[model samples]
Target: MFDLRMWFRALQIIPRLSKDEWDRLDLVSRWLIATRAAVFVMTIVSAGIGGILAARDGHFSGLNFLACLIGLVFAHATNNLVNDLTDHLQGVDEGNYFRAQYGPQPLEHGLMSVRDVLRYTAITGAIALAAGVWLVAATGTAALGLMLAGVVFVLFYTWPLKHIGLGEPTVLLVWGPLMVGGTYLCTAGQWSWDAALIGTAYALGPTAVLFGKHTDKLPADRAKGIFTLPVLLGEPLARRCVTVMLVLQLLAVVTLVWRGALGWPLLVVLAALPLLRDTAAVFARPRPETCPPGFPKHIWPTYLVAYAFRYNRRFGLLFLLGLLIDLALR
Candidate 1:
């Protein structure tokens, strides 16, 4: 019998499945857990921002919108699979690496074999590429170019990009101008600097989440000779950087309102101020080695990233809601 409960849990949290439980999971559930589907909401938000912005601009296609969302989500899932596979092959995820401690690293944790994970990656990547191809055919050369750029990021991100302290910045670019702007191009069939700019505002949320994850893993990364941004900047400075990004996200929204690109409804994102404030407070301090009180016990070994993810979900939803209202009013 398909375990609907496990399926839902996998969608919401990276469930730590035992060997038998892992075996019992259906293929869809297995893929969901392997791809870290819980975080796929970020990509969905980025796609929604792009599609909604395109609609507001009076150039929206339902086909294009669906293609963009599916393509981005599959691309993100492929990236997650690649990250785990690369780290596993490189031995980066060995010896209880921070990644495996927080969530299932399929290959490293023996939840999946090399062949199994590679099959998953190939299938997911092919679907994303197919969607991109359909989108390019529909939109023309511009969409083709955008698809190529996304492929470059997807292929190289975990290996050289993350290793060279470009991972965090990569997230910003990919989630913001690349995914969102690309969605606009695919759906609107034209470019919009305004769409790109607004997308960047939402982009900061995922960027902050990556910064938090990297910061949380700084020590382990350092010991393993991994040079993530946090390992490069040191934990204290990196945490401060996250705070700066959060502030910039807010500032970006205000600037857009002032420029008349968005309406007062967009200011509703300010409703997320409390969550942002709490996230900033957490980022201001070093991650505790032990589980802090009131922290979710199941999410242990994940500190800053957990808090950042919470803030990102809240802010993203509010931003999307504001954009919807803005669209309705316009």
Candidate 2:
């Protein structure tokens, strides 16, 4: 296997992981102690969405969930290493010590050698690609295409492709729909509107991530000549766009209802009250409280709202608990 060969190679570097390079591992952030949790949450959300869709059809595909989860973790972790390396190469992440210390960027702070980043990316990416191929072979060719597109998106987003004003959308579209769709297909064994509607909840998660990150890094972005959505769209237009996005999200549920994609059993999924409230909070601030208002920028995705909307895996627990109650009371 690709992984076994790498471990054998590490044997050649037996003394490499010595105390001299202990600081090298500082590249990955340890502040939250929950990087794996984030990955797990995403995997579960993927499987959960698949499960809900399968439930709609009166059948379930557990093997597909497992296969998709495995493939997703490998791909997500590979994307992390790629992003870390690309950010370091582009000068966008070198000085951001907090990002290096707290985010998964091991290369920025020398936590892992540049060699480590490269080696791990190759090994991990190969593993992800292999898993994806295996899933596609057993399931359908569509899964393979999804995985391939994912890699292309991540590569372009972190490197040459991210240089434009469109990085934010590409990131979300990659993180949200691609992952959701691929994972759903692994389980459902086919595509349907139910899967898309289920995936739609998760699709919002990445926007929250991008907006949250943008709010925090507006200064860094402007300094670096990065024209994010807020920067390109301007404050008023940006806020208006976000409002419309929220309204459209609500309308999706209605449209789904009309199309019978959503059964009445889960009709109450309509009550994402916090999402609505947070959308309003974004409109409350015209500009970053820390930055002056007249500048060509605004800060709507405040940390308060960002963290609030973050796709916490624990939310999956609440979702499962709610499902249990619904089943028990029924």
Tens digits of per-residue lDDT for model 2, 258-301: 77665444445455556556655755566455534542222232
Candidate 2 displacement at residue 59 in angstroms:
4.5
* Best candidate (score: TM-score): 1
Clashes of each: 0, 7
Q: For residues 1-330, write the lDDT of model 1, one tens digit per residue.
A: 777887789878999978787898899999999999999989999999999999999999999999999999999999999989898889999999899998788887788999999999999999999999999888888888789988989989998999999998899999999989999988898999998988888999899999999988889999998899999999899999999998899989989999998788999989989988888898888789999999898998888989889988988999899999999998
Which 10 residues in a row give candidate 1 its minimum summed lDDT? 1-10
Q: All candidates' lDDT scores?
A: 0.91, 0.56
- Over the full model, what C-alpha lDDT does candidate 2 score relative to the true structure? 0.56
Off by over 4 Å in 1: none
lDDT of 1: 0.91
What stretches of model 2 exceed 4 Å from their correct place?
Answer: 1-43, 97-104, 175-177, 286-305, 311-330
